[model samples]
Structure formats: C-alpha cells, structure tokens
Target chain A: MSRPSTRPGLPRRGVLRLAAAAVALPAAAVLAGCVPADHAVTDPGPGPGGAAEGVEGRVTDARGRPVAGAFVEARGTGPRPNPVPEIAVFTDGDGRYRWFLPAGSYAITVTAEALGRRTLAVTVPHGRAVRLDFVLG
Target chain B: MKPFHAIAMASVLALWAAGAAASDRAVEAGVRGPVPGPSAGEAATAAGMPYAGSDAVSETELAASGVTLGTAPVGPLPAEMGGSEVILNWDSRMVLKTTLYPNRAVGLITRNGAHHCTGWLISRNTVATAGHCVHSGRGGTWYDRRTMRFYPGRDGASSPYGSCGVSRMHSVTGWTVNGNRDYDYGAMRLDCLVGNTVGWFGMYSHTAPLNEPAIITGYPGDKPQTQWISSDKVRQALTRQVRYRMDTVGGNSGSPVWSDRGEALATSGAWGYAIHTYGNAGAQYNGGTRIVSAVLNNYINWINRP
Candidate 1:
C-alpha cells in the first residue's frame, strides 16, 4: 500500500525533504549544528502555538526483515504535556511509520503477535525530526 | 462630540445585548435528560435470567442495602461566555469496588489477549468506546471482531462479570475513512447480554455541558487489568469535543467521560457526556469526542442493532 501522511496536517513532501536533507549532510556537521533546515533545531523548547515535531521510525524483527502491520503505540511521558493521539499507528509495507507530535517526552511501544513488544523512550525536540526504530524478536 | 460617542457606545451595547440573549437561548435549548437504560433488576426480569452472576451485585440487593450511587447532582450550566474554561485538576485513584453501580458498567477491552483500551455498556448487548479502539484510523483497517474481547467489572486477575466476545464493531466514516478526531467514537455488539447483569451507563447531553462533573473509569495499561478512576469538571466544551483535566493514560482511550445523576430509576443513574480519546492538547487539557445529537443518535441505533 502507498504510504500515507503519518502526521496529520503535515504534508508528505515536508517529511521526505527532511529525510533527504538528513542523508546529504555529514553526521559530524549536522551534530555540530551547522546544517540549516526548517525542522532541524537543537532546542527542545516550546515553539509558537506549541508547534509539533516529527517522529519517523521503522520496525523490524530479529531477522532484520521489515515487520509490516506492527502496532506502534505512542504515549506522552510528561513533565510538560505532549499531545499525541491514543490511536496507535502501524508500519507500512516498508516497516516505516511517521508521526507529528507536540514536542515532549514519549514512550513508544511496538508490538505484534508472536514477536513480543519493545518500548523506547525518546524526547521529541520542537520543530525537528526524531528517529525511533525498534527491533522485536 | 458627546452625542457621537454616546451613539457609538449605544451601538456596541445593542450588539452585546443581542449576543447575551442568544447565549441564554443556547443554554436553555441545550439541556437534555439522561436515557436511563434498563436497570439490573429490569434487565434480569426481562431476560428471565438470574441477576449478579460471578460476584456481581444484584440491583435489588444493592437498593435494599442502601448503597449510594455516588454521583453528583445535575448542576446549573455556567454562563456561555468562556463557560468551557474549567479549573484543571488531576487526581486519580484505584477503584477497589468495581462491582458497584457505574463502575460495573465500565469494561476492559483486549485486542488479541493484550490489554488495549477501555469501554462501557450502553445496553444489554451494546458497548460504547473510542473509534480507534474498534478501528485504527487512516492508514489502518478495522480490527477483526474475533480477536477482540470485553470484560465487565474486571478487577486485576478477577473478572467479576466474566467476558464477552465482540459480534460486530461499528464506527463512523469520519474516523474509519477520514481519520477525523472529531468523530472518534464507536460501539460494539457483544455476543452475550453481559450488561443485563453488570448494568450500563445512561448517556446525557447538554448544549453547553461546561463545569459539569466529569468522571473517567477505565483499565489503564500501566495498571494491567485493574480499573482506575479520575474526576474533575468539564473544562471546555467545543461543538464536537469536551476537555478535562482528569488523569488518563493510553489504555483509557474508550473510557466513558460521564457525570452521575444519582438516580437510577427516577432518572438516569449516570450520563456519559463524552468518549475519551486523545491525550493532552496544546493547553494541557485531555479531551474526547462530545456526545452531540448525531453521535448520540448513532449510538442509540447501534445499541438496537441485531
């Protein structure tokens, strides 16, 4: 199936452009805060109207194959509030999923039948893309 | 010059007066009574079945024992101007007495043996929950009914009312197709009439359901199979959603955001105002899809579906 916009209200082009830019930049320069992109910011502070940051990730099994239809549940681990919906997103044919959420800490859990579940805690920075991948055995 | 200013102020006063009048009309027109579905006694009598199976409480015994409903009275609606803004209060507790009224109505939902979400009974064989609980939105398809189960009055490791398998699940096109959060409510048809013994919550709607006591009872994933509860006032009531400061986690998605009216037979025992959905929003208030006419009507139809 064609991958739909993982984050509601954000165009697919914006996510693709961010992904592409992340690839082109040298890791050392990007880490040193030299790369300038609309969604690449170091500060995790709140933006205007509590701007949403992007969270895109992939899920795979222990065998390193993409695990399609794995349920990815995201919950805000809040000291400050994060507004992610309770609706769990699933991986596409490529085992990739993306979500835009208000910048805050989140506990993302990936689960599928027989493969078990794995949870990762990540703090989403405002106006940036955070990658969170999972491997279920 | 004084006359000109007076004319301007008068024009402003006239507009304000008109607005206030409309606001009053809206509040008055918004008041709706609860739909108290069959009580445990009534349901048992109608079905010709024994009441209170598996540690459940019988309505007759509960009434005779003088147990309180523990619901708030029907309070007056606040002024329409900024009425939705309520004081944020976050406090929740574990409910040890899950077999009582209103508590027994709530249920734990399991999708393929894993604790997924919460739901509540609206009829003998019908339940109301979040749309996402029944069908994953947008990129996801509807969940298979065979893999889903509902357990009423389920304490940790002790299911007082047993469990029922889903016969069918129902959701709106807005959620199933468009993935709209405004229409994030759904219902399920249970294979058995578990609600007849465990009871159900009546739904209440008001045009301006602001400042009303909001209670959420559900099994949070953090707590495993146990049920927890939180209570506060409706902070904000939009056209299709209501916001509150009640503490909730992921599995509390389909929990009923209801206000108890304390009268089971005389009026509704409790009235569900919204179906809890998403987590906290920009303003830090968690919310759900408010039960407007369209939503309530859809639930009523689903409750009666074969």
Candidate 2:
C-alpha cells in the first residue's frame, strides 16, 4: 500500500516536514526475507479499510518438504516495472513470503534450492490476501 | 528528532560558493531550476504511475539463462553491498533492448580510466552523483582533476543511449572542502537534453525511519553487461543521510537509492531519496546523502534555470 500524501501538498514556498516515526503508518509488507528465530514479526498489516491487498504462500520440494531462502520474484505484466513491482524476494525458514501489492495481476517466479525454478501467475483482488503454495519439481 | 528549518534558496548558493557552511555540511548546485519538465509534483505523479504486474517462464528457460538473483529481503542489507552480493541474471540482461526510461537515465561515469562511479538524470541534461564522485576531498581537498565520461545504460560493450560528455559540474562545500560523507552529493549538466528522451527521476525530502522498501540501482564495474539492483529496506534514516543494506560496488558511488513512494509523497513513479556514497560490508551498513538536503534544492533551482 502507498503512503498518504501531505494534505494540500507542500505550501507553494513553505516545505512540509515528513512526520517523524512515520513507521507508525501501515508498514510496507516484507515481500520476502528471513525472520530470525524467536523474533516477533512486525508485518505491516493491510492499509486502512483494506483499500489494498497482499499475497502470502509457502514453497516446498516435490516431496512436500518446506524450503527456505528460495528466490521469489513478482513481476507485474505491465509495460514497465512501474509503481507495483518487477521485484524478487526470498522465502523464509518457514518457506513463506508475503506481499501487499496494489491490486494487479502478478507472475511470480520461485527459484527453489537445488531443485531449480518455476513461475506462476495470480491476480490479487482488492482488500484481501491471496494464498498460493507451490511444490518445486 | 532533527528539527526542520527552511533556508533561503538564493542564499544557499551564495553561502556555498562563498565558502560558508550552511550546516555542518553544505552542497553546491548544478543547473538552476525550474527546469523544462514536470514540476516536482507532476514528476511525483509520474513516479507513482501504477503497473498492471510480468508472466511465467519454464524451468528450462531458467536453466538456459545465467542471471544471478538476490538472496535477502529488505531489512538491513549486508554492509559493503558490492563484491559477491551482485551476481548477473540472464532473463533481465540487456540484449538488443530499447526502452531507456529509468535505467538508461542512470549512467556510468568514468574519469582517469580508473574512477568508475554511478549517476542519475534529474532533468533533460543534468546528472546527479556523489560529491566525491566529482571530487574526492580526501586528505585535505582534491578533485578528480580529470576529464569525465558518461555512458547511459552501458552494458558490457553496448551503450543504449550512447555517451554524454560535459564538464559543467557542482558539489557541496562540505565535500569539496572537507570530504565530509554527510554532504557527499553532486550534479552535472550535459550539453544536450538526453533526459528528454531517457526521462529522469523526481526528488523528495523526508525525515528519518521512513522504513520503506528501497532499491539501489547502478552500473557496477564488477559485473559484466549488467546493472546491479539490490532491493532492501531503508535503515538508519537520519535527517542528513539514508542507509540501506543493498549490495553495491566502488563504481556505484553515485547510484540512486530509490523507493516507490506514492504520488503524494514521491512525485515520480519511484523517487530517489538519497545519493549513495559509501559501503561498509563488515558493519553491514551502507549510506548516502539524503536527497532532501537543502543543497539539492539548489541544484533543482539551477537545473530549472531558463
């Protein structure tokens, strides 16, 4: 989700100060990263009124064993990388990655550890989280 | 919290040129504003233009390519982002590519056949880089003192937008005089409007702990035919500097630390918040001068000059 713009914009000549401790706003979701053991997850939750949405899922081996540190890339079918993403991330020890994308269709690529790689397409709806799990062949 | 104080725009340039330290550090402007392009707000809208979202390729396709991918997420990136962190990927590799919009607008700047640094286009003809890129005030004070060359989107042997050569450059007094890393930002003016074709990034000024996902993109001298981009989270957001864990190399000195802030915040599709200047792999922290520094506003004014 996007950060709120300064209301009325910066006065023509006067500069507006960005709010300190702005992390208090809905955090941008961690697309993919490692979560240390015993550490609490401060996931940036959905934006106000669920105006936006996110996707979360796990990656596993064909044998169904969870995989971690696998590379996951989410590319929007747009003409350009754009405001959304042509972004790549890695799964965590729990074999999971989560993202709050501006509503759009996405082609996600997962590069499994030692098993090779695969790509999947999904259209995320507004105001919700979509779950899609994959088994690396 | 660093208190915000607006300085007189005109006096910023005068103070810098006349050797007055505006703050602990001072910046010099290159090309006066309002340049012939979108106002900062309009550019922010361009920066925030939305994407529809890319599709699936086969495992065989992945096997056939040789592109290196990143392994970490947007937290604190490894210090000294260059070296092993930047590996080449094949799918996104430059072949007979065409669009130069954002990538090509970023360029490889070289001097003395040895100094390789990165820079980004802010207007049709101006390039913004680290002040140390233009002049390393190392020891006492010493500029590159050599002719500089720029290759926009130069991949291996290919130059997508050809090369741009110009000498009109500017740097902040802190860097030019004392080599202070906090004030390490610079800008250059080209003779032609390369940005009119390539498009440029918009600028924004904000305070600490933005904690947003950020990407540091640049032409790394270590990689072959590749522009390395490491996506990570912004860390240690001080009033004067922004830090990230994205991987970068020596040549990436002036790379842009860009974030996809919204239209209300960033103005362009994704706005660059800082001018990447240093890397500290061991400490696991790399940083650059924040774009919001008053010195940069002076460059915005300089570039906008009629």
Candidate 3:
C-alpha cells in the first residue's frame, strides 16, 4: 500500500461479456485440511522436460521428525513489478512437497504456526530438480 | 502511464464534490439507497425529478430533488502484478472458503455493469471496500450506486446469504479530491439488511499488528464462481497500509485483510484491519489501506449518518 505507483484502473470500458465459469470440485474434499490422499503422501510426479527444473523436499521439526501440514511456499521473481506471485503447497503426511517451477531463484517461507519463523532461499537449476529439506524448531 | 492522470484527477474531484452535495440532500430527504430504477442506473441524467422509496421518502418530501447517478465512479480493474492464485488445503478439507467464517461475509462486489472487486460487510447495511472499488477516486469515473451489487458469502453461482444493491457510497475526501493512495479505502450502504442476515466482520483501527496473523478471503475474478483465501502474517505495518505476501490475482482488489483475533468481539472471531489494493511482484508483498483512525472515523459517520 505504498503510494500505489499507479492509479486505480478504470472500470472495464464497456461490459466485456464474459462467460461465467463455474467448476465445482468435490465440496470440502479435504481431510483435516491436508491435501487429498493422492496429492498427499503420494508423489505428484514431475513435469515435461527433465531439464525444466523442479524443487522437492521434506519438512521436519526440531527432533528431525516429519512435520505434516506445514504451509510451504516458494516465492520467485515474477513478470510484473507490483505483485510477486509464488507457488505454495502444503507438506503431505510425510512432510514432503515437490513442485516444478521454471528454473530460477526463489525465496521460500514456511509458516508452521508453532515452529516460529523460517525462511530459506532456493534455486531451480536450468532443468534440474533440486532437493532441499527444512528442519524447523 | 496510469490511466488516472492530472486532468482525470481534477474531474474526479470536481464531479465528486458536486455529487457529494446532492448525496447529502438526498440522504436528508430519506433517500436511503440511491434511487433504484432504470433511470438511476449506471448513467446519471441531469434532467429528471426524483422518485421516493416506498412511502418512506414520499411521506417526508412532496417532490424529491433530482438526484443524478454519476457515471460509475469505479472504473476497470487496475493492472495486476502478474500473480497466480493458490487454493488452501487443511486436513484434506479443500479449505471450504465461505463456511470457515460465514459471518465474516467476504464476497465479490460488482459494479459498472461488469467490473468486480472484493468487499466485506461491516455493519448491518454497510460494506467496506477499497476506495477505488467504490469510486475510481484516483483518475477514473465514479460508478452509479445503482450499478453496484454485493454478493456476500457468495460461492460461485450460489449466494448462500443472497445479494443486494449499493445505496450510497462514500470515500474519504482526501481520496476523492487528492487521489492519495494512503486513503485508499471506502464504504457502501447496501439497500438491504444483508449484513444482519449473513453477518459481518467487525472493523478495528489504531492497532499496530506487525507480523500479526492475517487472513484474506475474496472472490478472485480469475476463478469465476469461486472464492480464495490466503492465510499469512503482516509483513510490514505502515502508517496507512499493511503489506503481506499473499497469493492473489487481478480480481482481489478491495478484499478485507483481517486478523483471527476475534475472541473479544461478539461476532466472527476476526477483525478487519485493511482493504487490499496493490502489491509488488519482486517485492512479493500486497499492500492494503490500513483501517487507521482517519478511515475509521469517516466510515463510522458515513454509515451512521441519516
């Protein structure tokens, strides 16, 4: 909310008739707020080019035990200057998460509520899947 | 360059000032919500006598003065910081968006025929939104109140609590006149008692909640028929805004930025602190107009005014 470098946008010039999109997934189809069984615990597999680059890792608590349900996010430099978009996923029961992002630099922030605060910088090599783990207090 | 430039800014001030006078008199004449008719639609006409609402206003005034509906004060969606939205998952529950805090009343606000922004009900009939969402204070035109509609607790086509039209909209004169980003907050009077039905999030100001757990929920136009929620903490608390790195897209403008510290409030255990407006990509943070004393006082009077 720094002085918006830009002014408020105009209402659409004319009504741009847009087809309303309504795609209803199974209502509340989550268990204990963790991802579904398939996406959770199970590896979501990798994307196209083996060289496309990805990041996969496990989250653990102080004692080195898996920290399930931790909110993990990888924030990367985005196209625009104002809004920085990022890829966020929850660690599965095994406290593991894997997401393929265009090879680049990123800052990952983990919010586990009780674990205090932990932030780490990660990289998606030009076509390499990097493995990094977090040990939270 | 931004669409709202010097000339546009001046027009916003002049036109807004004129409308303010009419709005004041209209309110005194028992004109609760804006005149609701085809004439009061998005385009305000200069030549016309006003009608009354039920016997409510006619009982008070024989001939209501002509009230012109300004062209939509709120204009198009501003440039987005090029971001994507992420749905939340909690215990495999898909993080059902609306029920988590039904009374919080987070939903999409529609205006100017097709424009959309996010807002939340603060009173029985008053809603708080980004200043730009109610009127394009910076360089855009003011939206006709008749063209505004609020869908509280809206989940896709299903409006669990129902929808209502905007009656009167108000933004700080600083915003309307100076187009100051610091004053990027506004409120709208709804034509119906929707807040009483769906409940509203309580608003609090004058608190410095740096790093406080903050939650944002809104209907992102990117995901039509769906609402998204971001659970994060305040990264920076400024004089008039709070910054956070919450996943958001084009349609999240005017969203309520609230904290889960509602145990003290008799309503939903959430307190609204700001209205999400702008964000930065590399900076990785979104900024919202913090509900400071200035914003709070203006809104309290606007909502409580006759």
Candidate 4:
C-alpha cells in the first residue's frame, strides 16, 4: 500500500498517473518531431534581446554516440517577407554545433562521411534558443 | 627601313592591342567602376553562358554521396584540423564603416525573412554567392525569389545602401542537379541596380593565385547582421577551389575571396577570385569556389541578362 498523498488535490495513484503523463509528453513530442526530449521552456540567453535567434544542438550516430565532424547545413525556407539565412557548420569534437539565426523556417540537413545524411525542417522563434538534435542513420 | 625593324614595330602594336583588349575585359567585369577613358570593348561575349569550369568534388561531397564521386581527384587541401575557434572581441575586427568601396558592395543576404548569408555585387544587378545559399542541393529545392533580400553595407540595423528584392536566382547544373560541392557557387539578380551605387566586385581567373593576399569581408553568424573581415593567403589553389586559413564562420558563404592586386585597395585593381563557400569543418583551411574562366564567362553572361 502506498502512503497517503501529502496534502494535494488527488490520490496517490492519480498523482502517479499525472506524473507519468508529464514525463511522457516530452518523449511523445520528440517522436512527433516537435522538439527534443529536453525542451521544456525556451531559453533566451542573457542579452538585450537582439534581433537574431539561436539554434543549438548535438549530433549523434544511430547508436546514440556523438559524431564529430559532421556537416550541418541549414537553408531558409520561409514565411514571406522574411526568410532565414543559409548556414553550413560542422559539429565540434563533442558533436555540438550552434549558430545565431534570424527568425524563420529552415530546412536543415546533416551529413556525415561514415553515417550518411538526413534533412529536417524547423522554425526558429524570435530571440530564443531552439534546440535541434540529430540522429544519423 | 630594315624588314626586322618593321616587324618589331608591328609586333609592339599587336601586343598593345592585346593588352588593351584584356584591359577592356577587366573593365567590363566591373573591376573599377569605369576606366577614366573610353568604355571597355563591347559587353562580355555571351557564347559561354553555362560552362562547367572544372570537375572536382569538395571534401563534403564524399559524405553527400557515399560512392566516392568525382571526374578527377581534388588537389591537396590544407592540413586536416579542428573547426573554427570562438573569437573574442579583442581578437576580431568588425567593419563599422560600411560605405567604403568593396565593403559597400559586400552585402548581407537573407532567405525567407530569417536566414542569412553573405553576397557581393558582381554587376549592376547581379550578386554572387554560394550555390547552397540559393538552393539546398542533393535533395532540396531552389529558394523562392519572393523570400530573398540583399542589403549592401548593412551594419547592424542600418542598411546604408538600402535593400533590393531578388528578381532571379542562378546556379550551375553541378550544384542544382548534381549537388557537387566544388561547384558550390551561384548568383542572384536584384530587382534594382543597387550595385551602381554600392559598387560591385571585379572578377578574374588566376591560373596561379596562391600566396596572394585573401581578404574576406562578410557577415558571420556569431555576430548577427554585422559585417566582419578576415585575411590570409590562398594556401591551396585547386582546379576549381581555393583554400585559405582565413578565419570565418557560418553565414560567410558567398563572401568575396578577393585580392586588392597589391595596389593598396585601389578602386581599379581589386578583383574577386572565388566565392567563399566552405568552413574548415575538420580541415585545416576554409575555402571557396574558385572563379575559373568558364565560371567568369558565365557570370558575364548572367550580368548581361535582362
């Protein structure tokens, strides 16, 4: 038997169910290509709120291991009047790459010599750091 | 007069005529506004609109297509190394004064309403840039003109030369069709002739441009909408690419890889040799798509277009 819930608005089992749902929502979003598993609230780092937005992410291989030296190319595919910039950057030794981009939609492609390539579309909100991770096939 | 003396005089006149013709071509390429004297010979010939200058795959191409693809092997690249370093404010220089000649012509390119890249004016209306800046390639479509804009000499919030919407975009089959990295160059035709005011960069094909000073001025991703510059010498001049150790980051694609012809940035002497396209990635050098004769000819053709 579980102990009584500590001064809350639900039974112990109900609280557990709600907690499970909370934990599963992010994973479901990840599978749905909404955001990464860790995306909770967008982080707009310390600044005077500059016009440019940011995209920061890590690249990993199929086995979930960080893959360094991968080329991540982002092409702007827009909303109208304002399009995103075209950018191509490589992942660091820790398989991380980040860039500041103006707000807009982007078609991002990741290519690795050994593991191959993949493309995904993402929209960066204004003045926020959007996390976009990749898992190569 | 002796027959030898007559022949010598004729030969000297012939050499002068050839030199004059070459000079005219340089002027036509928009090297120095317009020479002080007569106009350059008739506009660049249109006979070579879509010439594939050379056949070489970029190091990135190996990954794009796992099948080791290329008509010829690319020449030696710079030493393999790490990615670009994060620069500190003291170590970096930002071009605050954007009204200067070549600086004014080098503009910031934006796709849709958000994406950014660097482009330099090559003609009254044509802006040269990286092919990837216009098209995704190897599984991507061309960027729509409705979403593109160019701001010459844009420093932060100031677009000193105003802005021009894209009328047309241009790229070669190697990039648009084949997705070849060595062919990663393209251009945009602006709706207005802004280059006339901001000035455009002159282009030339150097059979050997190695060791010539390479000054790349463009907007870097780290510093949004701000233009910065880096300098170095051409470390490796391949068949269709030029590698340099110049510091650069994302968003510098299509920046002019140019030389001031050792004339102290004379308005008449600067010429672009390549369109900066790639960062070092893991390689020891950053590189650009070299402007070969065929590429230069194609640019002339594009420039002359309506």
Best by lDDT: 1
State the weakest 10-residue window (summed lDDT) of model 4 chain A: A35-44
Classify candidate 2 by CAPRI docking class: incorrect
Question: How far does residue B275 in candidate 4 sit from its true spot (Å)?
Answer: 0.6
Worst 10 residues of 1 chain B by lDDT: B74-83
How do the residues B1-306 of candidate 3 rate in per-residue lDDT, one tens digit apiece? 433343344444445544433232211211122322223221122011111112122212212222212111111111111124333332111124353343226666875433267888666566778766655443334556776687765666655545677767777545544446677677787776544333455566636679887777775544544677776788888877788876565457777787645333222234577888764523557778887654655555555655
User: For all candidates, what are the clash counts?
Assistant: 1, 43, 36, 13
Q: What tens-digit string does per-residue lDDT give for candidate 1 at A1-137?
A: 87665766577766765665454343333333421111100111222222235578999988899997777777778666566665435677888876554467888888877798999999888566699999999
Q: Any runs in candidate 1 off by more than 4 Å, and if so which?
A: A1-82, A87-132, A135-137, B1-89, B262-267
The sequence of per-residue lDDT tens digits that candidate 2 reaches over residues A1-137 is 97668756556334323342132121211211211111111112222222225578999997888897676655555443212221123577878876444456777778765888888888777556798787897
lDDT agreement with native, every candidate = 0.65, 0.53, 0.54, 0.63
Question: Per-residue lDDT for A51-74 in model 4, tens only?
Answer: 335577999987899988777776
Worst 10 residues of 4 chain B by lDDT: B46-55
lDDT of 1 by residue, B224-263 (tens): 5788888888888888889988667667889988765443
lDDT of 1 at A132: 92
How well docked is model 3, in DockQ terms? Answer: 0.04
Candidate 3 chain B worst ten-residue window by lDDT? B46-55
TM-score of chain A of each: 0.59, 0.56, 0.54, 0.57
Q: Against the true structure, what is model 4's DockQ?
A: 0.03
Q: On a 0 to 100 scale, what is the lDDT of residue B126 in model 2?
A: 69
